[model samples]
Target chain A: MNKYISIILLLTLLLLPLVIYEDNNSRYEKLSKSLLCPVCQGETLFDSPSEYADDMRSVLKEQIDNGMSDKQIMDYWTARFGERINTNPQNSNYFLILFPIIFGLVFGVLFYKKVSND
Target chain B: MISSIGIILTWFGFLNLILMCFSNKKNLFQTLVRINLFIHFLLFCLLEVGLFLDDFSLYYIANHSASSTPPMYKFASLWGSLDGSILLWNLVLSIYFYVYVKFYRATTELYDIKIFAMIILFFNGFTIFSSSPFSGCIQLASIGCQDFTLLPFQDLVLSEFGRGPNPLLQNHPLMAIHPPILYFGYIGLVLPFVIATSELFNRYKNENWIKIAEKATYFPWVFLTAGISLGAAWSYEVLGWGGYWAWDPVENVSFIPWLLATAFLHSSKTQIKEKTLINWNYVLACLMFLSVIFGTFITRSGVLISVHAFSNGNIGTYLLIGLLIFTFLFMYIGIKNIEYFKTSRKVENIFGRSGFFVANNIILSASALIVLIGTIYPIFYESFFSRQLTVGRSFYDILVGPLLLILLYLMVFSTKIAKVNMNLKKWIIENQNELNISLIISIFLTIYYRASYKFVLTIFGSVLLIIIIGKNVISKYKKTKLQGSYWTGQISHLGIGIFAIGLVLNVTQSFSNELIISTGDTVNFGEKEFIILSPYEEIKEEKNVINLPIKFNDKEKNASLNIFKNSSQQAISSPAVFRNIQSDTYITIKVIDDDKFKLIFRENYGIFILWLGLAISSSSFLTRVRK
Candidate 1:
């Protein structure tokens, strides 16, 4: 039964993108047209047929088909490039940066107390 | 000469600020700040005009300028680069510097204000000299480095038209307003730093600084929220994702500061309630400022390449130093004044909303920090290990999702929990009255969409939020609408709830397709179908595009997708939908394969609520004028 469920899950995952692939592409197309290409300053990937975006699109299409998930793809890229390929960088690695954050809060609280007391 | 003048003006700003600090003269700081402001304005005009006039002799202009780039874009290009953006930032800073000084001139707090101005001036001056937006571009040929500078005007190498703006930015009008609004929010944060320092120096500690800072903070926080919302709005309309906020790097940059500001707001509430939180308030202010620096770093450094980032040459070292020195100065001042943190307040109401508000700030910061780490880890990786790693949507969703749900839960219950000034027993009894039955009904109404199998989990999340909002609204209406802050909070929270619902719906129910279908072509999707009747073409001075109207027949209703340009041009979906009722749909058709065309269907609801949230949150500023 577990094996059957696993196969079913895999199939379902595969089918999900098939159903939504068109939607994803339209979304990409719309977004590509609207946002500036980060790699190429002035042109949109939608407007300019650059090889870089073309490669990214192909990779995106493959990921959609593989249904490997965003984490898997991100992990793969992290492995391939280290940590900078992420469109959104998370602040986990240098968590110590928050030391300043903590200090700021402490100071803010102190300032509030003294002001309110007066 | 202009650069020298700018340096002199910066020194003048510093000088006036210094005089204000030591002088016992009445309103000395105010007078000095005003003088400094005039000097800075003249300097800014002197510097920017060089670029605005396309004086290629100036390295700043040459690097950013191109022959084919239009005059209008040239003007916009002033802020299109990092050094320039920072320059404009100081210009805005000077405006606020004088205005704040002038407004508070008669007030007893002068030394604190002077310190704040001095700190800002030092940081500004250091960055100007180091990063120097006017720094002449290095000759790549001479240096033997490949030419990488984005020349603004250039002869079309392949076509008559210049490569259009990031397809994302050029795709919509919202792009124009979105960044500036975010900038306003970012800059507004500097004022809180000044006020916090002012309070510490005054030794006249009271709710006054919190009260003043709360108003100052809320205006920008509100603008920041609106700015974020409009970006999402632009995304939904222009990106064809049927959703806003892609969890992209640029979006994350806007979001992080917003989260810190939110924490600052909630912490202020704690201060107002128990007149304490000495350590915590400083932390929140510093976090907000840090977020501003971090967000700017992410955008300008050209380190994190994403659709939302603008490409100026590498500015990592410049950004890091600026962030470091500013933070260090604030830390020194705050720690030096540790005498002010003697009294600690008792947690009178852990079961109450005030406690919950503190928890909310914690959650907000934690989530923002997680995003911050994921966003910048690659930079560290590249700098140290010579490796580049990238984190994306799934990482954030998994990490922050549970915490956010808890936040949502707190938001739901906060309206019911009374504290401090409220008569809790009587308030509860009144809330329990017959009027609450309507709330129960509305809560059920909020759930209706989620109960449907066709709907997603976010629908229920939205419903839960709406229900909580319903309870709060019903309770508030029972009381008078006289308190502006209370009403403002009400509208703001309600708008947030509505926006939450809209966000969930947009993310879940949106539809997209990319294909090749032309005029008179028909494509069927799920329950909806699109028929392309005709194609229309439009040519402007800068843009050339085709417009097509497609008719949609779905479970919702018959709608049309207005799409133009696919292979040769950018795709634009002109969704003709207008209403605040929560669920609205727009359809656009893009011709990809001639007969096999792409169709995009999207639904955006609750944006009107987002705007309403802006209205209510911004109203907190009105309290400044309150008698």
Candidate 2:
């Protein structure tokens, strides 16, 4: 009985995070945070205090009101400011995207081979 | 006169270091080394006295001090600028080397000590030649000399009082301790770098190096963690923004070294336990040391403009040359002895403790590598393309955030993996009750907060971790004795769990907005009514300060946010915070005119928990250094 309970709870815990609902306000915030603050060195638009950042925020609001998707808004900024405008790297930067995958595979293979020989 | 004496002592120490390099008498060598270190320490003390006495005749003091500056801030000005900071760095390095030699000179080889001494001597030379703070002013006759004929000192005249330290530095008391603690952490790298380099150079055929390296790395790791936390705390307080970390180049540089050192600590532990990944440990140690140099270069070079970086100068080129020299030296040695890192120990179970450590290192190293590329790529891009690019928090969060989650999961999963051969049913039954209780509590909290499942999961994980570790601690104590290493490791893990929960709460629950209000106007903010009392302005010594009195809904106590315009014509905001057990109402005021003021109110929740966890984690590592 304890084993069955544990298994069910564990499964539910694993799947819990996938089920949370996100609202539009939170979505807007996340989008704003994903873009860089142009005037600041490393700050996001959501956190910057410059008047330019405030203008960007209003533009973001208008785009959202116009029914643009998150990706489309991101595209709009990227087109104007180049790839550096968005804080998130492009999908084309595969070296960064695939680093963990490549490193894990190579490390795992080496470990396995070393252990087998031992 | 004191400044000249300090410089003379430094020169004498350098000479002693050179003589000791060839000296054959062990006791004499030790004596000379001690004198060299003692003289360097004395020089720093004299410099500090100059700051305290408000002796503007010293070139450094004349430049960085003010008659009106408070006594506490006067001492902090010792490291408030470039040359003084270098002097602080020199003092820390000399003190650390002295302590290391005192403790390990008898057991360790003399050759290694000589090499380390050479490095210290090089630092001594650099500081004296390029960045000396002990420069006497001939006009006023301060320190050691009455004339400006000395090599390092020059004739200079100034007004009755000196200019104060940078306003940002003197604004908070945290500045007094932050730079010194960070310098200690940075200088602590000398031990591992020297030990690892010598080990690779001579191919030392003993296991004692592992113990020595681990022992030496422990204090620095704790200090580095503490320094980073203190820096973040300073930012949270001083920087008008609500966030702590901005993924700025300087912040990333500091964080990168900490990550690599953390990886080295884990990998070195694996080498101690299973005799595997020894070479990887060596590689990590060298990389961590190099990262410190790289971080220093980034801050000093002025290649990247950041709030935290020192002003730009030729110091960048010197640091770059130093970094390149050490990089090639370590690489050459690493290449020569790469074969020694390979281990024959085979893991029978992939889910065991050793495997978990391997996974931890991979994630840590990857994260560090990603940040390194992100930080350095911009410099290269600008040089080649004559354009600028930025890698900000958004880039890092997307890449490193998921990796951190995985690391957190492993932190819990590792507890179960140790006894992989145990019966699965028995294991589940043993832990099931506590797990269920934690889960139920998490569910309650999640429902009450109406938070996402991700947040709930974090709570569940944290609760589970605390309970399991608590049980282990109790059981271990109940048994006749407890393992110190196990106790410390578990406590640190518990700290990580707590920190993660705080981070989650901070991310999901924090609220911030701006409100413009006039006198007698009431504004609703975050479930509280803020009633503006009145606006007033006062002029301090060098600035104009504006104060806004505000009262919370039905609360007797009032809070005020102060805004000041300084000599630099820059407006600085000092926020007022209303504290509670679980949250705080932080307000920053910007004065527009006589009546209108803009107030930015940010509610920070669970940050204390994060700070509490940080204290716990750093103290736990400190325990590892003890007998």
Candidate 3:
């Protein structure tokens, strides 16, 4: 009886995301507002309220509606605007270099604790 | 009378302070130090009134004072302007210094005392000489204060009406008091700092300095907490900006010191275990002082533009230079003197109080660092890369969200998990009944808060807060309630918990509507309705402003709003109000119509929680004071 209950709960949890799938267009449309245009100094693509921003938003909407994923759209933007257009720093290079060091320092402490305890 | 006396007393104190510092003979110098403090108090009283009184003979009075200013503002106006404010800041420090001496008269810590005096002198000299409030007024002719060009003395007010303080200040009660309290709190950080620096040169034998500075430290800690909260309260009341802190550069200046002070207080517990986070503690103390200098520079220099009139004059560049040199010197000293504290103390457990404290410091510092960067990032970007940028909610909300989640988790678990040299489950088992009750209630509250967030991550935050409190509530129950320091820490952390809950509610649920409406018109907002009535008006004899009242009808509900304007002008600025709500419905009346009709409506998710948090946090201080 417990196994049945636990499995049922697990299945429900696993299936929740599928049921909650947001429209692709809506998700990307919201995300694009926070991203900056590479050519602009400080203005976000969604912020300009200009012809270019309007055009960009429309293009994004079309692509998203066609079922392109968030990552794919992001990749497309990176190619069009170069990596500079991205609001967050790319998860490569400096961030990549720092990530493992941070992981190591954190894990190193735990690793040392485990070894010492044993 | 007060004007001259303030100067004479300050200099006399300065002379003795110098004597105390240079003359190493312990007996002779200590006497001089005592006299220095006495004179400093007199100076404080003298300048305090000059700013407080409507005495036109005093230049500070002529500038910052107006007879129309209310009594509380009269006290508050003492630190209203640049020179007068520095005087207020230094005087507060002098009082702290004096209080420290009185409290520990029996202790013979000579080097620390001398170093403290030297630091006080430096602060005093900066206030008195460079940008002295005691320094007489400039611009007698300019801006028509005295009509500097022709017969300046004759033009000056003998009892003539002068311009009152900024309207924003006089409008709120918190503004009148919060700044000065914050200033004192900021200045108070210097004492522990100077003592810590002195400790580097001496043997670590004197644990008493921390004890001596304990109450003095808590005194400021309480005030700083009050000051910051009051600042938020003031904003919530007046600034129409619903949020208390905007991550504004100005706000960040005060927050940086607060973070450091909190860290210092937490880590100072290391003294109990024969081990210390000496380097960390020293850095915190020094960093706090650095934060004070940075705030002083930022406010005085007008690097960031705001309504604070204190940020007037050439003080900015000098303050910036002072900040760079001072920070460098302090950091250099800290790094160089690190060898003096080479006692390698192992952190006992990952879940212990000290461990939790270390984590707390990291989170706090990280928050402060982000704020610091975002605050000054624009300037650095402009100077270095010639790229100008504006950091807004996008920068703060997203960046801080993850950290806040982490902090909430830590905060909840910390109290539960961080037992200092005590048996945990054994303690809990004894008080399990109350512990379980508090735990259940906290969990319920967290769930409610998470539901209010409208996001999944809020669940995590809520759980964190519960863990933090549940652990501590159990511990506090086990211990005697009369334990002063122990109780204070627990109560304060409880205040923090309540405050976090409030912050979560406030941000998630606060609802506002911005729209235009004329009088006698009805507008619909969600299921609620607002009937716009007429504008309310009043004029005070002593002031140059007309106050208009707006009648608000929120879904057949009646409310009133007061819109203020400069008397000389036909055009007016934003509206002000004393707001009230029924059943979480926000009813506000703003003037949006040309016939000056009232715009009124109800908003969802009231910020009552914010107020609750502030009240709870501030209550701890009274408890602290009483105990």
Candidate 4:
């Protein structure tokens, strides 16, 4: 009984993503969070309560209603406000994110090898 | 006159520390340390009295406090700015030093005291010479005080009435306690580093230092957890943003030390039990201390753009130099005594308790490194590429999220493994029933809620972790009555599981909407209908508060804004929260006109669970300390 229940739960979890659909509201939230409020310090558009953020949110709503893709909407903001508008680093700076992971992997491997060898 | 006394005491304390570092006689050294501690305690008390008395002759009080400020806020005003905060830091450091000398002196050598004294002397010197709270306007004039108009010899009163504290600092009661608690945590980290570094320098081969260092780390680790949680609660309550934990530079820097210290705590356990990872524990202790200095630099130097950052000053350069000196010193000692702590024991099995500790260390260290990189990347990028960039929450969420998930997975399984060697298949077979039940509950909840993929995964992992911990705790309690360390460790891990669950639910299910409404206007969102009642104003001592009462469903709540009656006319918002076990209805009001107001209504789910988890996790330390 436990094995069957575990298998069923595992399968359901694996297939759960397929059943989840993205709506425009969630997309709008995602877009607003991905963009920073230019007027506020360290606040995203969704989080900032400034009048400028309100206007930007309205503009974002309009763009989403006009059926722009996520990339296109992102590009629209980045082109207007430079690359700093987007929260994620640029593609060229991907190495900055990978540096720590690679370092952790190397350290783990070396430590594990030493311990296992002894 | 009191300000002059404070200045004299600060100088005396500085000199005392310096003398204590050089004194070879143990009696003289102890005397000097006691005097140093006494002088700082006197200085802090003097500063607090000045604040409470509204002594405008003192420059810091005149700038930070007003006569009309409440007694609680007046007491808190000691750390309301940079200079006074440094005084608070020094005072806390003095207390820690006294406690160490009085209690743990038997385990420590004279050389350790000297090294620790040098550190104390540096900080004391920094406090006195660079950012003295005792300076009056006349002394401040030499440092380019823009508002100074008096002659050097004239009575250095700048204002008959003070300016009061920062509006944000005075806005919440939690501000009174958060900084002091956090300062204690930050300053307490130095002891472990001092112990470890001194041990390395002395070429001590015994494992007794590990016990002392681990004990030193536990209270600070608990305080850091509580401090960070209080800070998050303060942000959520006072910032009117309906969110906690923004992954800001200052916040990240605080968390970096915490993560490293937590890693040290876990690995130090392995070192004590199995005599492995001895060098790793020392490195972690040093890194934790260095990270605290780096965090202080990031917060005080104005190098980062954060709401929590202090004003830019020359102290940044001094702190950076201090950091470099300490880093070089630690690296030198670490290299010179690297072979002293080399372990000869082997882990015969990768699936055992030791491997789990190793994996835990790597995951936590990686998480800290990723956060550090995300935090300082923009600074490096701008300096090197001449381009401005913002590494925001998404950067951290993308990189550190998977690492945390892996950590949770390890926490779930690691407890079930044997100490030295374990048969993985037998362990799995033994825990199959519990595993399946956890999966079923998690999946059922996820399906019922229709959560996103990331949310689903987090919920699953958290549920599994909680179940494993709960089972282990029950079985262990029934078997032989759980040990102190084991009990505290399991409870803290259980708290993490609950915290993770609360975090995911709050992030994924929470929603906020803004509406423009006037008096007598009714707005509807979802099933709840909110009617704006008449707004009223109240005069509260130093400030005027405008409260907008709204009736949502069956309950009435007020979202108020405080307008301080100072020259600056600073306004702060106090959001109204209708809270329950499952969710909170948070409302913040912004007055556009006499009758018009813009309000943001946020429904935050599982916030109570988050606080509950923090309470459990932090309180476990108290139990262990008692034991």
Top DockQ hit: 4
Chain B alone vs. reference chain B, TM-score for every model: 0.78, 0.91, 0.83, 0.94
TM-score of structure candidate 4: 0.94
Q: Model 3, B1-627: lDDT tens per residue?
A: 444455666667777778777776867755665576667666666765665566655555665667766777777776677766766666676677776666643345576677677766776766555555454433443211442111122333343544555555566577667887777777888767666656554555565555544455676777788888888767655543334665656777888888778767776766444355656666677788878888778656765543342565667776676668667756666776666556535565544566566676666766666666656655664577664444555566655566667765565545544444334555445445444444444445434433422223443345345455556556566565434665566566666665565565555544444346656666676555545555545565434333333333522333333232322311223234324431144443333345653332334243565566556655555545443
Recovery fraction of native interface contacts for candidate 1: 0.19
Reference A-B contact fraction recovered by candidate 3: 0.00
Local distance difference test scores for all models: 0.56, 0.71, 0.57, 0.79
* Worst lDDT 10-window in candidate 4 chain B: B143-152
Show pairs that collide, candidate 2.
B1-B142, B1-B143, B1-B144, B2-B143, B2-B144
Lowest summed-lDDT stretch of 10 residues in model 1 chain B?
Answer: B155-164
DockQ, per model, reads 0.12, 0.32, 0.07, 0.51
Give the lDDT of residue B615 in candidate 3. 64
Q: Which ranges in model 4 have alpha carbons more than 4 Å from their true place?
A: A20-25, A62-69, A90-93, B106-108, B139-155, B343-346, B418-420, B478-483, B567-570, B590-594
- State in Å the error of residue B45, model 1: 5.2
Residue lDDT tens for model 2, B299-360 = 77888867777753568887888889788878888888766755425544544667677778
Best by lDDT: 4
Model 3 residue B339 lDDT score: 66
Q: After superposition, how far is residue B437 of candidate 1 from its true place, in Å?
A: 6.1
How many clashes in each structure?
75, 5, 11, 0
lDDT of 1 by residue, B1-627 (tens): 444444455556556656656777664655666676676667567666764554443455555544344455555555655656666677667776766665543247456566566656655664445555544333432211223222223221211122222334344556557666767778878777777766665664544777677767877787787777777777655555444555667788888888888888877877776766756777677668777877877776777766567645536566677678768766876777676655546555544555676577667877777778767765776788786545555456656666666676566556545443334555445534322443333334434433222222333344555665566667666575435665555555655655555444444444444344666877665444556667556764444455555555533222233222211433444444434465555564433445444544444445555555445545545433455
Better candidate by TM-score, 1 or 4: 4
